[model samples]
Target: MVNIQKLRFFDCNCSVGRVAYPHLSDIPDVEGLLKEMGRAGIEEAMVYHTVARYGHPPAGNALLTEAIKNNPRLHPVWVLLPHHTGEMPHPGRLLPEMEKHHVGAARLYPGANYHNFSLSEWCSGELLGALEEAHIPLIVDMDTVSWEDVYKILDNHKQLPVITATCTYRNNRYIYPLLEKYDNLFVELSRFMGAGTIEDMVERFGSHHLLFGTNMPQYTGTAAVSLLTYSAIDRTAKQAIAGENLGNLLKEAWK
Candidate 1:
């Protein structure tokens, strides 16, 4: 049995993309992040790129890859801008990079980067098919895009495990329906704290569909950790959300 309280945490949502705001720019450095994670009982994390403006997606990806390369406690999630250049990057090349870099997943920010929603023809079946073949889960920012559009995107790729980032109280209405409709839809609990959001999601989707996430830098890691550590869910359920779910998903993919 998994020990919920003692479980390691894997933050599925994080971005070092681009510092668009001064507050974001002043966030803790990697060492500080590790200290915070240790304080919050997080044993490991899967982080993505945030420097969107400097080199677009690839720059952020490179930065994160370098930062986490030596940190066994951290894992890299590669960022891809399918809508950039008005054409998807060659999957053959991109997938190999992810594999070479030991990236565990692929992150997309249609709303954050102003890309066409995943439902767009540009983000075609071929692109998704490649991701599936490569066994990488797709992480998206649901808060930025419309739920209807996200749903349509999921409809086209039902077999893909789609994780969402930056979820908040406002998106619960959309979240509930999507969780109910698609077994592959999973949400990272980051911005959706206090507000009874975790309780509500637990009550509906149970712990299986939820994964622990600290928006980190954007939202205080302490607050996000508190939400899960203080939740009403049982220890087993908490364990699943905090780390087991993500671990299980990754193991399945790697196998």
Candidate 2:
């Protein structure tokens, strides 16, 4: 068996604060999050606040910055809202603050229904244009954005990069078409449990499109790492999924 404890991994998806799931115990705070990362050999993670996904964006984004600003290991992902309603800062104003706080990416929570404005599957030309210019990629989960909406967004902004989280084995049919069409679309392998799916994705698409993300605190951080470690792909591909792919993406997003 591979010594998973010794392998350094980077988790692209993580969250802090309270989740409504009553069954989860020992929810990690900032310090506890670091400890959990240490135990799992996770070198770093891109995290969002649990509040950000379902609560007010400005408040949640502020809290996320406060929680992770001093730590490089925990890169914060800001939650965004439609600018027309003035619920959140426009991308013009937000990108500067994001740079100041060292945030690497942004997310949208369409399902939270906190506001009446819609994401239009990210098809808002004004919003998508702003993000494309800012160079920050969009992150979403199945609960937040639907596949049909995501398709609409991609159709309009082919150059805009997006990473979808909480994706699972059953999403293959939809994922394949997106992967085939958009070079900028990425999928996290954390919850993907389709048997032999990872190897197949690697074979069909290059390793660059597959990223490592553990829906941590809900799922064990080691779960994705273990799944990748024991997969049939070569070591380079495994390492890419572990950290390299995300590292390159982050570097490019800010450039």
TM-score of each: 0.86, 0.92
lDDT of each: 0.72, 0.80
Candidate 1 per-residue lDDT, tens place, 61-137, comes to 77887777788988888767663464445777777767788888877666644544454645555667677676678
User: Cα deviation in Å at residue 83, candidate 1?
Assistant: 8.0
Q: Which candidate's TM-score is highest? A: 2
lDDT for predicted candidate 2 compared with the true structure? 0.80
- Write model 2 residue lDDT over 106-159, tens digit each, in one string: 888766454335667443557777777766878878766789878877777777
